[model samples]
Target: MVHPDKASTDRTCSCRINTNYIPLKLLYLFFIGGQSCATTYRSLFMRHLGMSTQQTGVIWAFERVVSVIIPPFIGALSDKSRHPKAVLITLFLVGAVTLSSMYFVPQEESLNLTNSNVSASENVTAATHVDIEEYGQTFWLLVVLVFASSFSVVGIYPVLESTVLGVLGPQNRYKFGHQRLWASVGYGGAALIVGYLKDRSAESIGDMTGTNRAFLSMFAGVMVCYCCAAIVSAKLPVRVKRDHEGFRFQDLKIFLKKPDACAFLGLLFFYGIDSAILEIYLFWLAEVKFETPSFILGASTFIGAALDIPFCLAAGYLTKRFGHKTLLCFGLGVMALRTFLSAIVVNAWQLVATESLRGITWGLMFVVICSYTSKLSPKGLEASCMGIMQAFLFGIAYSVGALAGGAIFNLMGGEFLFILCGSATFVATVAFGMFSFLVKKKPYEMKDPGDCTSSLAFGKEVAESSADVL
Candidate 1:
């Protein structure tokens, strides 16, 4: 028989746990929905503004660098903050302001430099056609706004994921996919709507060009969604740190000594390369190579994001059945397939069909990576671990991929680039799968201080074997 006091306490705890679900779902919906508004069509926006592919890639690479540098610091700060929700609110506001500012940046009217070679072939002297100083100023302003947005936007993910994981606690971690699925719903819905709005805006005759019209609608949606997310963030349960007082650099040594962690980070870098290539260039292929309409491009993202919803909902079951490492390999394999198909597709619809695999590649992959990282992180360093993981996945790896992709696309064209990305992903996936099979390391656990020696010894042995294999 349960004592009255104990039963009451259990009921209260259960109620608190139940309350987090709605807010978590809404948070994912609004935040990711906000990002999808601009992210899906950003390349097109810049292109419409007369910026060259290389210029856009440079901006993207710089933005990713900021993502790498900012997240770890933000994560650490969030971990230590007495009011973590306030930190999130501030990030939301910063992102809202900076991203919206991009919509207002004046579009380059006279210069249409799509490639460096084009600029040379046209024999266009900047002094004859346009003022070089004014052009440089406009371009640099876009860069500044994008960089400012990056500081807040990229930093938000790690802190948000850590907070969600902390709220769900260890036992309920798998249910993360359930909460995250709402992001797909929000993203898909918003993408579809925004795409429709862009088409409508494009059809209208006005002083503003179609790109500016589309961007105005996108910025409006982004701002509204972010503001709503900020408002809802206040209701989030503040995580109480019980195991340690604050995050310390020493806590990270435990993570660095684990061979599995090291290997996973390495895998994340390659994964970032594959993903970055796809995200940056796929639309370019459809729009430029195949002449796909804006609405169809938007429809493709909607379809992909819609597929993500089901996959995300089933992520927990899939993780349990196949395991994290296997699922990661599977996701990589699927990415390779997508890229290979993208290289061959002669039309936009077929490309869209191939992109339908986005759900399997991203939705399953994201949940598994976050869960695995959370499992590996030390108690007080959850946010820090997530931040580092994001740095590798989005920042460093993405920067490399973006720069390389841009150069390759300029020199060799999109088909060859996609083929190269496919082959690289395939090779990396196979290698990582084989490595994990040979490693057979015990699953990571938060160890007591006394267990450090044994853990370090095991890590050393694993490292030695890995070096021998290499």
Candidate 2:
């Protein structure tokens, strides 16, 4: 619900961009760093604790627990603050302190033992063999660090990204790709560094202590990157009213009964499953099916992701040239084609080749989704809607995607399972796509900000809004 009286049309704002270009660069870096450290680095970091597929599963599950619960809740908090920028800055500082503790936390033994059973001494995580108690202590410490670093994902991320979008407005949407391109650059660069280190030092790191030290360096690198991101985040000029929504707990009961709300969730139900397949299975197709080493997995994926830069730019152009719905359909259709191709990929080269197709679909989807979400954002609850989107939908999607993807691999065999993922994407796309079209009532006009007094809380609304983006 947007307040019709809220004269704060984001496009019309005149706040000065005192620290403009450089902060934008830092924003890109921090955005990438925040995502990689908070979500992507978990696999490598888990190995250091000698976690098993199951133990690692548990750790990730725990992290997802917070991700599922906190982001939207905190998003509500961000929506109301007089200065959401301040809240974002504070989150970074808190994350820095929490993440720093990873340098000194004890390891978890039970998880480490599981990893050893799965992989040999050489194959196991470097710290796996340190006495179980020490490992347990560190693992527990990591649980805290994971929670802390997640500030970027759970709440602060929407706050920060919304701030960037608020500044860029509709005019500069084309540049959004450029910003995300920097994120791909950071990940690709990090991957190269990690690959070089692992290849060059694999033999010398035969000793457990040496392995542990190397993994620590990786963690430290992630922290350094995040620190730089925090610096960039401090300087963006974002202006939006900050006040809590008036929706209450009772509204939560009938929240979905609203027509647009029902249609939106229905669209997401399948969209999420399809999106989850790509998130989890693509890497599997590359790493496992192709027998690509873990060290270079990031590098290979980054190569494919690098292709997304052009797609992102193209997406911006197409979205602006055509419309949000058109590009989204195109992107989803491309993904469907890619999924179909992935099922039959026979080698690493084939996988890489087809994986290149991923950029257009993924890049287009991202830009379209973000743009659409921005259009529907209520006057003040921008972060809240974004939070519900990332956490409630995609957060759950990622977690289930990981576990379910693995199960699919085991049940159907990797090739067949991947094929199934592609098919699901295709079928679900049609289903969800139709629903998206069905919800075209003037969702925005029906619900004004005044209608959504504090009686409403965060993302739940009687009409379609930003949460529909996910």
Candidate 3:
């Protein structure tokens, strides 16, 4: 009964929509798979390497900063040449190599400069089975190894994200939350397994030397996983041609002209530090509050990645419904509430509940944060926005926060340290909500090209409080 002309129009529309969603689906699967593989094992690797809480925190912050700083120029080059994939792939290859080296570096004892005065080296020395450093080569090699890793990732992550975004289109693009959720799933699975290993090994490898070997093995696992991810990354779909428009430093400057962009970055920056705080402290929290065995600490992380799936799926639905910023605000609220509740834990069971809280707060929030950022950048400006996000939030601020977290954890006394950590999350949540509110009196649609493909398609039509997700 439909008119012939209308039927033809409908057919064409359906065709375009199919064309749009299919590529994005593959892109999402690939991205999630690769990211999970990379983040999950990589996280376990860092934890195993005997990096101090302070060192790990700073490393995380620096990694973000370095990633932001270097990628723009590299991405600009890739963009100008119409080959975003070129730069991204090159970085991946480098990452595969650099990450491989970390496995061999000797694990060291986590530095406890701020730690409570405990038994000195001499007290444990007599009972210790073997010295961790025989030739001492492992200790010195660690510094070089980490530097390579930091450099390789800095080169790859932004470019990989930008290309994926570019290919997905604007409307109903690949979902960032979905991708992040999988990454967490990967992380959680590894954490749980490692938790059991650490727990079981404790009595057998009570010696520090034996424990170092187990930790070193974890680094090896990360390198293998990352190498595979790099190989998969090479096959992602992004055309290697510059667009009609030219890219220059001026394009990077466009971020300042967009308030939504600034506001989102501010939220991201604070949230980055807050999440970093949770990650660095979760194990310690487990030990102090639960009196848990090391095995339990390892077990909790085993589930970090798995738990992220629901949040990732939710992010997709939420981005389609309440919008990314609103979802982020909501997530932050949930996290702050969890942290505040955690401040009052009375038993080990309560500690387990706190881990769940940590996962939800940091893990799920990671989903929309990256996606919203992707949605707010102008075309070809994905790297710059990513860079700026890294520069402000993750790089210096987080690095400092990591250092501060360790200092404060030592200085403040554990009895009430939960309050301090919770306070940071709450403040960040408050800042995010307040600034987001004051940005506009009403909802408005604004589009920015992201590091995802779908952001370019239907999302091309941006609006406040509503999204054009297919």
Candidate 4:
């Protein structure tokens, strides 16, 4: 019934929508594959290589340093080129090759002293001996490969985040919760599978050699996933080309000028320390302190990740109703409690139970933080802002935490280390809560901004409720 010209216009609109929709679907798949490779098995593989706690911490800190240096540059490059997908594809391929090469690195079994009450200096001396006598060339090779792979892997995140944001546009940006849930599914699924494989390998083959073979299988699986992710990344389409002329460090001054932004970044920095400790130390705690089996350790990860799905799905609704500050404070408070409890756990089952808190603590916190940061970013500088924020959170804060955790683990042992981290997080929570209460918004902005006004009112309510405690 339509005229030929009208019909042609309708077809063009449909084609445009399809183009954007297809890329988003592919990007989701890429997340699934990428998370499977990166999150589920990296630390376990390192442990299997006979690296001591301090040695592992040093290596991880080096990776964080690379993350600090590279992601910003990659983000800037993508901003200029207007070819984020191309950049991502290249990074994925590089990551696949470098990470796969890690499988071939030789490892000699070192002294297992995780349970000893060794001094930090003593641990360092032991680690040095292992590096020289047992690790040697293979150790340096692994470090080199990690540096190279991390340069690419860390860079991929901001680009993927930008692409997802671009695809969703302003109107539906809040719906990012739905998209992120897929990553949780991917992590959980991979953790379960990898854990089962590791347990079976240990049972069938036996000894340190069996563990080595299991780790090799895990790395191989990661390579396959990376390859699939690269293929999917290559197919993504960039809809808009942002102007990149006159870009300079001065452009970042806007964030520094805002008091709220500074407070938020500080909060993120402290939270980063807590998070890094959990990621780096929890596995060792399980294997050494509690004598938990490989399958159970993997199951713990799967449980945490699986539980994240519901929290991620509900993030948007929760943020909308309770506001960012309340959710953030609540999540941090839960984290403090989790860490304190972790310090007291005597058995593997108790540790598993404590880990369930991760769903609320990390899951909700990350979603809210990402959304908040995205909303606060200056135009055309989303990727840069994200990169800088990540550098502070994962780079500086994580490095400090990792190194200190190792030293603390060696000097004072697990209980004291957890207590220290927990106390720090608790203090941060109180400081953040006080900041939220005392920092009144300017009167010049008389017009009520819905979320901002709601957040302020919520802060006032919380302040009143805890006045005596404060």
Candidate 5:
């Protein structure tokens, strides 16, 4: 028979683990799953609606511009707010509605064209006028919807990361990979399922065009997943440990003074540019060059995401063994190779093989960057740090990539664009290594006595504060 105290201890430990892991797992699974359901196919949907690649790029770049302006403020707000979870849930709901609504916008070909008793030239002119008006309206509407969705989704991402880090506390941060791997599972699985369904005949899905109806079906899945995610967001243990010295916007300057920190941020910006180009144009390349099927494209993504599971699980170990600076170089080196391979791949299967290297570049890199950012974060200002990171990675850099990549792809072609990106990444990786070697490490001296270390205390404080609120 087990000793009574020991048994109680075991039970308590199990409960604590469950309380921390289960809700976050479900939140990631459903939230990312919902996003993947639509995100993987969004570009295709825009293309199907008669939008040119440049037009699509313009829309994406515009949204990234908004992300630049909004996410940091939202992160600051979350840090200051007593009820950050409520704000996150509200963002989720808004993002879900706006993103899903994009699918239901009337297709360009569906515009009314019937006109009786007109000369041929007159009719042609009238048709051109109607087409221009409709195209402009549709384009602007899609842009608005995309902006709204991006504002909520991008703004919430860093805050969500802060919540996860806060809940896990500093000691258990190594397990972040385990938590993040669930997002890959959700992404890969959703892509696989939706792709399979999308590949089905039009007759089976009750529409003459398989792609259009498939996206409509995806809208329903997004709503269900988002609703579930919002419900579970309430369960997240987000405690705001009120610091006597409140986080000021200017406090970030002190944190940025470290040479290594500045290098990392610069790396992220350039890395963002290369990654955005791939994200925006890779599938389009596969489709246009090799006539890749929807299911094959999905399979490619599934394969890459599946690799993320293993890579993410290994991230902490890799960082522990090689250190963050080494791993950053390694990840960038891998990205350069991947981009170079993308330029030369002649077949869809080869494209998939090359893309699967994202396990290292995207998956491992994400974990490393997030962990590094967390490590560098000042006490009581974790959200602000993550927000700035997101702004650099996804907002400003992504916008530049989208706009520049589109122009490059139009002028020089996709293969040439990838080659240029790959070469630039390789050069950046080398430059970063040289910079890190030259720059001396600065000792972090806190300007204020109110500050503390990176370690976060969670659980009981959260429970007590939540109870008081309730």
Candidate 6:
């Protein structure tokens, strides 16, 4: 019984909402579902695969090396082609395939060669057999797959951030925090689910075989999530303006001229080192030192991620009121305090308690740094600027940090490692706070003035202005 005119108006409104609102909501869902599969289970999977602490560090270092080399090229390609959504979908598909391959790699069987009455010749034979079977084809295949998947997947965040920034603009940049809170929810929920599954499996089948099987299943689930992410990414609206300007080498030089940008990058580098150490070693600390159950280990992550939800949801409002620089310094300071507290933990529960600080530190740091980077970027080169920032933070800084932290852990144990990283983070926080004093803030204009309907009059004025300039 609706009138034709009313029906037509309703349809138009629906289209506008679909075009504007749904796409961003889907991006938020993408973060939630995608991170649940990737970050929540990756370290646990590697540990289940029997990688030692040092060996795990080497693999992560190599992965970061790939992250360093690939993201910049991908960023530039996204800018020049103006098809970032397509690029993101392609990367997700490739990453899914590579990640799935890891689960199928065969596990090497351990050899027990000890015997009281074995002859020298028999001992030699056993030694040769053990050497041949240990770390064979399957082990190296997993390493290669990890590197390949990491290279494909690591560029995702910067591109996604660029797309979000394009849609939100500088004035509405605070909304980015609330959007990212969904990712925290996804990560926490996924960790809890995976943890419960692993615990049940272990109870039914015993720890060794059960945990390994659970790890394989987790990787399989990650593949499915990545596929879903690819589908969602395809639907994302593209708004970044594409010009014939192509990629310019000078675009890279723009950040160099700004001292504030340089200082921010430096702070990111040191903090990257601190974060890398924690990511690589935290579970190892819990498992080896505290002898925590696998489910409890996962619960700790869940708790930390859950804490992030509220902080991230409020980050935009806080940033707007207190300023990005203040938040940045505050986040780094929290990290320093968290690291110092983590160094003194005597029990698994205490470690979990310290992890609650992650909400204030990591959740706040990522949102603010990303929004601030977008604010600082030139009008057209947003993706490239983010890419460069990530390259510095996740690439060079992460690699050095992982390698050095591994070596330090091997030589000096966890106490010294924590102390060292905590001290360095504290120093960086102080430096960044001091550097902020020299940088002047500029007011941002949110409205576009070029949307007049008198095209003929605008065209005539443009032609006359061009002739005068000539």
Top TM-score prediction, candidate number: 1
Q: Write the per-residue lDDT of candidate 1 for residues 280-386, one digit (tens) a residue.
A: 88887777787777778878888888888777766655655667788888888898898889999988888669879989988878887876776678765666677
At residue 37, what lDDT does model 4 achieve?
A: 55
What tens-digit string does per-residue lDDT give for candidate 4 at 1-470? 99999988865553333345445545554555555555456665666665656666777788887777776778778878888778888888898788778887766444564446887557656655565446556557778998998878888887788777767555445545556665666666676677788778777777765236766556666777677777777766556655553235675797677787788888887788888788788777767677677677767777877788778766766776876777888888888888888888888878678878888987778888886675566765555677778878878888888878877876788788888999999999999889988998433221222222234533432332222111
**For candidate 6, what is the TM-score?**
0.81
Best by lDDT: 1
Residue 416, candidate 3: Cα error in Å is: 4.8
User: Candidate 6 lDDT, tens digit per residue, 1-470?
Assistant: 99999988865553332245346656656555655666555655665655544555677787887787677777677777788899888888888888777777664433557477988558545643463446555457767997788867786766777777666554444455656776776677666777778668667776563235656556666787788778878877668775624445577799767787888888888878888888778777667687777677767777898898777766655665687788889988888888888888998888788888889877778877876776677876666777788888888889888878867876788778888899989999998998787667666433322211123323422333222111
Q: Tell me the tens digit of each residue's lDDT in model 5 across 1-470.
A: 99999988865654444455677878888888888886777777776665556666787788888887687777767767767798889988998899889877765553445356767556544544454445566578898899888878787786777777677665555566668887888888887777777767334766443246756656776888888889999998776767623336676696698677788888887798888788888887877798777788889888998899878766755765676778898899898889889889978888789879989997899988886776677765655677777887889889988888877876688899899999999999999989877877554444222122221212332222222111
TM agreement with the true structure for every prediction? 0.84, 0.71, 0.73, 0.83, 0.83, 0.81
lDDT of 2 by residue, 98-149 (tens): 6656656443444334443465544344443343324355566666677676
Q: Poorest 10 consecutive residues of model 3 by lDDT?
A: 461-470
Q: Write down the RMSD of all candidates, one decimal each.
A: 8.6, 9.3, 6.6, 8.6, 6.9, 9.6
lDDT winner between 4 and 6, please give it. Answer: 4
Q: After superposition, how far is residue 161 of candidate 6 from its true place, in Å?
A: 1.8
Give every collision pair in model 6: none
In Å, residue 200's CA in model 6 sits off its true spot by: 1.6
Q: Which of 1 and 2 is the better model by lDDT? A: 1
lDDT: worst 10-residue window of model 6:
445-454
| TM-score of model number 4 | 0.83
The 10 consecutive residues of candidate 2 with the worst lDDT sum are 461-470
Off by over 4 Å in 3: 1-65, 80-90, 107-141, 171-180, 198-206, 244-252, 288-291, 302-304, 341-349, 358-364, 413-418, 446-470
Q: How far is candidate 5 from the true structure (C-alpha RMSD, Å)?
A: 6.9
